[model samples]
Target: MPPNSQPSPPVSPDGTTDEDAVLAVRAGKGDTAAFGALYDRYVEAVYRYVYYRVHSDTDAEDLVSDVFMRALRAIPRYEPRQAFLAWLYRIARNAVIDRARRTRIQISFEDALAHPGVDQIVEPDAGLLALADKETVRAAIARLTPLQQEVIVLRFVEGYSTSEIANLVGKREGTVRGIQFRALEMLRTLIPSREALA
Candidate 1:
């Protein structure tokens, strides 16, 4: 209970200690070691999340570092109301937005789609593959609304489940599904078939 002492770990209903909550509490009280443990545990997941959004390895790595720094500074104020990862993701999401605003850098849709993960999204349609080259796909993706683009990238590129995306975006699971459905429908319309191109 001392000001500098670590708090007891939070116990779940099943009586298991929540490791993340424990680390978060200790970090909140100035325990750099606990904060480092948290950083080691989540850095990769945060990197992937940022990388897909920015579509740049260099930018993503920089943003991931920024996210952790921000999280560390804010740890004293952090409440374990949600998963620590979710809180970190909110910081990352904001960092990406802030970088975009500061640099006015338009994310390259071609680069995003060039990632191997995107093949999984477009592979179901042979016509799409045959007709839509990187430029065509890029154009189609760029035409999507920002929210639609985010949903598409998170779902297809990051492979997050609807519920997980809902948590990250602070939307309902049903809403995430609706957004994904609408985004996919828009993509179908935007990307012409091979027959249409012919």
Candidate 2:
């Protein structure tokens, strides 16, 4: 089945049952509704991850589609050994790498938001808002190495724990934490004005 294009998971006034792994297992068995549920759950996150790497709404959207397409095909092979989010993110990271290699794409993070759509994907930070432009924040992040970029985005933006990030990135937790620190240090240097964050 194609990736779920459903708007959102259903919720009654009381609550809704939407455990990701359960949905994934069901989807693995060719349950279209279950797969759609999974799609609704992860689409925004996948888009956010892709947006940071590609820095272009069009590219990010395309890559997100690709990620889901690949996911749909591979769900049958997915095991519950890890969180579905972790597995999905691994796929996304790989997709970005593959696309970059195929196209020889050179990402310019600062200029990525020149398109209107990406602005919605990356909520402007209070500090970044102070920069008086999203591009400034993008430029600051652009200066980070790819690993630094992933660490920073996952750490601060997505709020993933170091261990969780380490699992996703295939690094040790210490390494992920160190990368986060260095990425922050680089951002501090690149965006010297504290008010830029204010």
Which structure among the candidates has the greatest TM-score?
Answer: 2
Question: How many clashing residue pairs appear in each of the predictions shown?
Answer: 0, 2
lDDT of prediction 2: 0.68
- In candidate 2, stretches whose alpha carbon ends up further than 4 angstroms from where it belongs are 1-18, 107-132, 192-198
How high a TM-score does candidate 2 get? 0.71
Q: Write the per-residue lDDT of candidate 1 for residues 29-106, one digit (tens) a residue.
A: 999999999888878867866664564578779999899999999999888765676677778878877887888866
Against the true structure, whose lDDT is highest?
Answer: 2
Q: Cα miss at 138, model 1 (Å)?
A: 8.5
Candidate 1 differs from the real structure by a C-alpha RMSD in angstroms, to one decimal, of 9.5
How much does each candidate deviate from the true structure in C-alpha RMSD?
Answer: 9.5, 10.2
lDDT digits (tens) for residues 3-48 of candidate 2? 3332222221123233677888999998999999888877987887
Q: For model 1, what is the error of residue 186's alpha carbon versus the real structure, in angstroms, after optimal superposition?
A: 4.6
